[model samples]
Target: MIVSRGTVAFMFEGSQSEVLTEFLVSARSLSEYRAMFALSPRDLAGRDILDCPGGAASFTAEANRVGARAVAVDPIYATSPNVLAEQALVETERAVAWAHHHAERYRWDFYGTLDAQARVRRAAATRFAADVRVAPERYYFGALPSLPFADNSFDLALSSHLLFSYADRLDATFHVKALLELSRVARQVRAYPLLDYLGNPLDELVDRVRKELSTNGITTSLVRVDYEFHHGAHTMLVADRSN
Candidate 1:
């Protein structure tokens, strides 16, 4: 079975019988990022962007192709390009299988069908694999709460499917610290799907983190975006550093 982003080990209230223990590295395209973050053309033109926990996403490759200087940061990037490329394909398959099994948990409007979604992800993984081999510098080996960039190094930082999506494993403190770290490197930060992998909302955690960010001089707002694969997950958390 394929495991897609946010399809990791977690039991919903009364759905999904199997438990997945590992974090599934999934691939997402640039178009998906645009919709998920409400990113405009201006957001991409001549901007420096950072994608943390980038997984196998083609966002960095595609964004750079269109004038943006985008870099992807993930511990998996430490793996050899050939090995990571192969692993991405295998994980993409697992993600697809997981998504297909829990089809009802997701809204198919954006993808139209499971097959289409699979194709899009597979293509993204392919692009990421090829790009990593050619432009390895664009992919950095780093994790949240501590990145290797200078302060305000990026115009925007995009974090997807890792914060609220893994709330079961990552605590409120981690979220606050990670968001602060992202804000440290970029003027603005956006994280999508303020819900757990089970499609369950983490309202309290979100609220707590937002309040903490406010206390720390980071302004946060909940913004609805055009993307919703996980049902009821139409919002992205936006954090802006105080200028």
Candidate 2:
């Protein structure tokens, strides 16, 4: 579709705007996961990885195809796959509508145009939906600072979008509790896109959590990552248990 500077003027030849919107529901691929978490294949190999708030992404599914032992935890996993798929479609439409209304706020560099953006998203969602049909056990339904797993259960813990992205909805205490649970489960905990949905840096909250974590003997660092799907989302927060 034609994503112009000021208006959506016309559709491209065989533009898959509707199709793209359907597939681009929500999910970051495995490459994105590796980039955000600063992980190589060797890092994930034979490691028990935890993906918190993993949406319709193929990270766990694809990682398992190689050698990593990965699992996803998200509230949507509690619902039936069919129901989740339907909800994803609705969310995709809503997101597209929001983008259309406020086009200026977003930098469409990563996604060239709106139609391609939808297409890519739809593909990720499709992969996730197929994987769920084969093995739903890889997914667990839960929220955090209160996960169901035992302490020190995972080798690596990764979280995205939910915590810092919704800073307005969740406060500093919530972040602390979430980080505590994440740190409790794994030796290495990494979270990315440490910015609000409206593109605000969460330095104050990050600083608070960092100081509190230091007090508890956990080391925290702000790491620059290679991924920048969102503006100002160039860094990730890494927390490791101190010996």
Candidate 3:
């Protein structure tokens, strides 16, 4: 999420236990969640939200408090909260170090400086950890390209950074399939900063995603957002499937 795309950050530890295979970073703090998802209190009112790849963001914690039905699905939730908390702290430190070393690679228009970025991430993680202590069920252990939910399960589904950020690693077929899965469970899906991890646009993949969705009776569009930490990466793809 540091490449001017969105705030979905993850560290790859390769496959483990022959079962644990990938890490999907969704640790963007609450404020970062707002910027990355263009979310507001109004946007979540009385809606069921699915945060796919929900690493450790405070969006679900915050949203659930306000009467919104929010659920965070990620592979990390399968582990013990204590373990996830420890791993999250390590990753946060690593991310902060990266931002400090490669400040120029980020836009800083929203977060301002490396110090603020660290603070936000730390705070978000803290909020997330606390919530886990009280309500662990809010965080579900799961992965994408496939979701375990009934059709029309949620009203808003938020997937940031991952799908397009790893376009090269995840081929066009994976992108289309993942979007379709998200579309299946949620009425509306919003994915931001439609660019690859290198701050480069995934033009072919983007077009293909929209085209593939359209063929399935879904409509997609790139909507301009208020937040843009990466230069030239200022839009989010909003897709709506017919009921």
Candidate 4:
């Protein structure tokens, strides 16, 4: 396993299909996993979207279901905490069961919960193509950053746990830089700043996100999700396209 910023990225040498099959089997329930898709703005139909820090592609599947071309970019491949097989199994199990639980909400056509899980696993195995050489902030285009991307390459970009997890450990400026970089790459961005991890107020963070977008001459709308099932307050900022 290779490590980066205290996270592990693993690589798998066998066929991805075999690895994905086992992942589907362990995905028994949709508990914590439901939160990922539950918060996505359903209005984004027909829009090209990007799920940055896309863990197991839960958001990626949402975008795909909505008829949008979606891409998932994360550094998990570069920093494997364990073997790729283990990570794939764990993440796939979490993600598929979540999807299966909300099959009705997503209007999915699976015959049963088991079928839904199987479908997601098959889809991931069939479509999971990621090149570790590409930089993630570059909109599905290059190696993990330290390298940035061109401006306005994406319609929507989202991260579930990116900046918030780095607060006390990293310099304040570094956190700001990553957020700014994410805003730079995306025309519209939605981010769930993990509350338990960063302890930053959701309102304050949305204001900061708004200010960051404003600094770049873009208008932004920030919606804070506050619901019981999604107990954690997450910030969803949508930047208006200037063109």
TM-score, per-candidate, Cα-based:
0.93, 0.83, 0.87, 0.53
lDDT by residue (1-243, candidate 3, tens digit) is 111122234433435221112333445865666777788888778989998877777778888877788998876778788777766666666556555555665788687777887888887777787787688878876677777789999999998777887665678888888889999999999997788755788888899889998999999988888877667778999999976
Show the lowest summed lDDT stretch of 10 residues, model 1. Answer: 1-10
- lDDT of model 1, residue 79: 80
- Candidate 1: stretches off by over 4 Å: 1-18
Q: Candidate 4 — which residues are off by over 4 angstroms?
A: 1-42, 79-85, 90-149, 194-213, 218-221, 226-235, 238-243
Candidate 4 at 190: error in angstroms?
Answer: 1.0
Q: Any residue pairs clashing in model 2, and if so which? A: 20-118, 20-119, 23-121, 23-122, 24-121, 24-122
Model 3, residue 100: displacement in angstroms? 2.8
After superposition, candidate 3 runs with Cα above 4 Å error: 1-26
lDDT of each: 0.87, 0.74, 0.75, 0.45
lDDT of 3 at 226: 81
lDDT of each residue in 118-231, candidate 2, tens digit only: 666666666777788778888888777788799899999888777787676678888888888899989899998798766788888889989988888899999998777667
Best by TM-score: 1
- Clashes per candidate, residues 3 or more apart or on different chains: 8, 6, 2, 12
Worst 10 residues of 3 by lDDT: 1-10
Which has the higher lDDT value, candidate number 1 or candidate number 3?
1
User: Global CA lDDT of candidate 1, please?
Assistant: 0.87
